[model samples]
Each structure stands twice: as structure tokens, then as C-alpha cells.
Target: MQKPKYKRVVLKLSGEALAGDQGYGISHEIINSIAKQVVEVVKLGVEVAIVVGGGNIWRGVAGSARGMDRATADYMGMLATVINALALQDALEKLGIETRVMSAIEMKEIAEPYIRRRAIRHLEKGRVVIFAAGTGNPYFSTDTAAALRSAEIEAEVILMAKKVDGVYDSDPLKNPNAKKFTDLEYIEVLNKGLGVMDSTATSLCMDNKIPIIVFDLTKNGNILRAVMGEEIGTYVGR
Candidate 1:
């Protein structure tokens, strides 16, 4: 029995990761598998807060580029995150994992309004909290939201779960010679335009002195491995 490295963590799940092999929409198999992994982490006494993205359903940036109103498109993207949050909540609850869906947009019937105190309280009580709706505003990505919420809740680190195993100089799929980086500094990520996170999110993490671990979540038990400080991903810090 190894000790968990962090008592609390934020798990950032990109919308594409939830879509799995289908490339679009929530893949039940994948979501269920993710849910199981989350449950395993919870059983380890690690508090989990998740920030989900909505790229699989709709990308606001793409819509705006196509001539739609930027704010309107971004709001639509926020709605998509809520959908992902609810779907994930359902999956977790099926496995009897206590979960809460806090929406920034404040749909009283479907979710509770985002409250900093309440969210922390949920985590304190051992409940998994899923942040939805992308900060309730446009122009701010879920990546920023993850950083924002992690700072607000004082999470030890952010588990940036992606399809890729680790950070690379280029897209590993397209370039056989791409170099993998096991560790990176916050300044390097910003100056080099690394894909670890948006500048705003990266800055927030750096400011808050929060570390981030980017790894491939599709691989089973990677979350636990990360929690145990097994070094399965690229570590980013000051």
C-alpha cells in the first residue's frame, strides 16, 4: 500500500477524450471506463474535481471562424460542457460514486450554481465535483476553468488527461522524430508555445504554484499511477 502523493487533485478531461474511438458524442464504454478509474481514485481518499471540455460536440472557435457570433458560439460550447458533465455524473452515480454537477450558467433544475465554498465543501465531504459550462462566460476555455477552479480550491496538482501519453515538441502521430519531454518549466511552456495549456491557464497554475501532470488517460489505471507519483506523464512546474 503506497501513499497517495496528493490529497486533492483536479482532473481535466478534454471533450475528445470522452468521445473515445467514435470521434464524436459520448462513448458509453469510454465514459464508464473513466468512471471506474475515478472511483478507484476516490477509494484511495483522494478528492477529485473535474473540468470537462466540449470540443467533441461543438467548438466555439470553429463556429466563430465560420461567421457565427463569437459570444453566441462560445455559449453554445458552454452548453455542450454541461451535457458532458451530466453524462459523466450519471456514469459515476451508477457506480455509486457520490458526485455533484456545478454549472456556471446556473440551470437550477439540472445543476447547482457554481459556488466556491460549496464546491470545496463537497470535496471536503469526499464527493467528486464536476465543473460545467466553462466559467459561465465566453472566451475562457475549460483549460482556464480548470486552472481557475484548481486555484480556488487549492488543489495540489492538475491531472491533464489527454489522448497523448506525454508532451512532445510536435504532434507525435504525424512526426516519427518528435521528441518527448518528461518535464517542462512554466516559462518554457509559454515561451515555446507548448500545447500543455492556454497561456492564461498556464499562468494561473504558475502563479498559484500548482504543478500539472499531462498524461494519456485512455490507458487504464494511469490516474492512480499519477496519484501515487509514478511519473507516467510530463510534469510541468516552476
Candidate 2:
């Protein structure tokens, strides 16, 4: 058997991905499919920490009043991430994978508080850890949260799963001439201003020397393929 390239990874899943075809809320079929893939990676001895976005539930900033405070809106977004965290926790456990939900915001009844050392311990013990609440601060994205957790946990890479196959020079949906990049250096992504992730998220990975593999999560087995470091998607690294 071939050795997996990475021993540990952080997966950043957008809430919309959890919605599946409905485009809203938790879809059991989608969650089950994702859980199964995660189980396969864990079986390979790859520790996984996941950071989930809240776009499907709500983006408070998108609904904030013109006079509303940005911090307040961001707080709402954090709660949305918590909702996603709980849903993922349930799904993973249903798949018989020991899972832990750690929140940046304190929610003692529902999950554990975000403690870096404790999270690392869980991964070492073969438990899946889900990180939620977006850095516990406003004005940050879940992408940044995933980067931060990956650095703290000493993860080998960041698996940035999306709805698309890979990053393109132009929106492939809008332009047929769009070209896909199979690989990229951090500087290339920054220089080109590609939307592989937010600028803040991209910079964090670049500074930490953590590569990101962007691929379509909806495609079966892509998560395990990424963890094995196969040539499946555009890799942005230094």
C-alpha cells in the first residue's frame, strides 16, 4: 500500500455543502455521504479537524442594517457556525466515528469550549474534532478559522473543499474560456488575486507554510484523495 502524504489535515466545509441539493439546511443524504468519506480518511490514520461555514443557515452581515454594528452581525454569524457544528457532530457520530465539537464561543451544554491543547489531544486519540464560531471574533471567516486551527494543531495541510472542481482564471459558470489551475504557489495566488479563499485566509496559509488543496467536496472520495495528496485539485503552496 502507498503511504498517505499527510498524517493530519484540516477540512474547511462551507455550510452550503451540507445543504446538498436543497441549497438550504442539513441534508441527511449529503451529510451521510461526507461522513463516510471522512471515515475512510480516518481509517488511513489521518487525523482530521473540520471548520464549517454558516452561509446556508445565515450570514448576519448580509442582513445587517445600514446603521447596525458590524460586530453584532458577526456574532450572529458565529452562532450560525455553532448550529452547523452541532449538525456535523451528530452526523459523524451516526457514522460511528468518535467526534468532538469545540466552539470558539462557550456553549457548555452543547459542546466543548475551544481549547487548543484539548483539541490536539482529541486528534491524537483518533477522534474527529469540529471547530466552529470563526475565530471567536468578528470580521473573520471560517477559512481563517481553519488556517488558525491547522497551524495550532500542526496539521500537514488544509483541505479546502468547495462546490467547484478547482480554482479558475474566470468563473467557469459564466465564461467557457476560463482556465483551471492544477497547481499554484502562494505568491501566484496572491499576485493573481484568485478567490481560492479570502485574502486573509490565503495569507495565513502562506505565512504558516501550509498548503491548501481546493476541490469539489460533492464529488465522492475527493476528501480521501486530497488527504492522500493525490493529484486531484489545485494545490496552493509556497
Candidate 3:
């Protein structure tokens, strides 16, 4: 059997990706499609861990702008991630994939509390682990959680699955002439404010020397393509 490019990876999914064209909440069809694509990569013997965002259901920053308490709003955002996590777990399990939902918060009835050793063990056993609750702290985005978990699990790379084709100099949807970058350095992302991920997440990954691949989640098989080391999206590193 051919070996995959990366032995272990963390797939960072935005809540908007789960919303598909609806623009709000979860889309069962879209989630199922993503799960199918993930199964393809899992079959390649890649250790898969996912960190999903909660922007679709709720955004903490948006809430704070509306005068909600900052910490309170962020905590609500964490719960939103748990909801997305459970939905993803359901989609993956229905496809016959052994999946686990590990929460940073203590929600024992629904998920396993985030334990570094337990999460690694789950990956070692070939079970897909979905990390929820965003590091169990307020003011931290799920992007940060993905970076944090990737470091903890020693994942080779972070697969940043986005709705856009890849990172563009400007919004591709808004700017017809926006330049697309095939690759970038982490400092460029920060200095240029490219918004590949938040500053903290980008900094964390940079400090840890973990490469990130930003690809379009709208396309089927992109996950597999990323895991196979194919040139699919913007590559960020060094």
C-alpha cells in the first residue's frame, strides 16, 4: 500500500462550512458529504483529529459587539462548538467510522473530557477524534484550539478546510482580480492580515513549526488530496 504524506493531521473546519449554502446552522447533507470525504482519508491510515468552529450558530465577537459580556459570549461560543462536534460525530458514525467527541469542557454525559493522553490513544487506535469546546477557555477561537491540539498530539500538519478555494490576497468572491497564493510564510499571514486563521492560532502554529494547508471544503475529496500531499490549496509554513 502507498503511504500517505502525513501520518497525522488536524482538520480545522469552520462552522460556515457546515452551513453550506443555507448561511446558518448545520446542514445534514453537507456534514454527511464531509464525513464521506474524511472516510476516504481515514482509509489511507492517517490519524485524523478535527477541531470545528461555531460561527454558523453563534460568534462570540459578534455577540460582544452587541454588548453581551465578553467572557459570557465566548462561553456560549464554546457550547456551539460542542453542538457542531456532536453533529459531526453522528455523521461520521452513521458512515461506519469509529469516532469520538472529546470536549475541553466537562460534559461527561455527551463526550469525553479533553485528555491529551486519551486523545492520542484514540488516534493510535484508528478512531477519529473530534475536539470540541475550544480549549475550555473564553476568548480563544476554535482555530486556536486546533493549533493547540495539533501541538499536543504532535500532528504533522493542520488541514485548514475553508469554503474558499484557498487563501487569496483579497476575498475571491468579492474581488474578481484577487491574487491567489500557492504558498506563504506565517509572518506574511500576520503582517499582511491575510486572515488564514486568527493571529493567535497562526502564532501558535508558527512557534510550534507546524505547517498548515488551507483548502476548499466545498470540493469533495479535498481532504484526501490534502492528506496525500497534493497541491490543493494555499500552503503556509516557516
Alpha-carbon RMSD of each model: 0.6, 1.2, 0.7
Error of 2 at 78 (Å): 1.0
Clashing pairs in 1: none
lDDT of 2 by residue, 112-226 (tens): 9999999999999999999989899988988889989999999999998898899999999899999999989988888899988888989999999999999999899999888
After aligning candidate 2 to the native by TM-score, how far in Å is the CA of 211 from where it should be?
A: 0.2
Better of 2 and 3 by lDDT: 3
For residue 114, what is the lDDT in candidate 2?
A: 95
| Clash list (residue pairs), candidate 3 | none
TM-score of 3: 0.99
Candidate 3 segments exceeding 4 Å error: none
lDDT by candidate, in order shown: 0.95, 0.90, 0.95
Off-target runs (Cα >4 Å) in candidate 2 are 65-67
Q: What TM-score does model 1 achieve against the real structure? A: 0.99
Residue 139 local lDDT, model 3? 86
Clashes of 3: 0
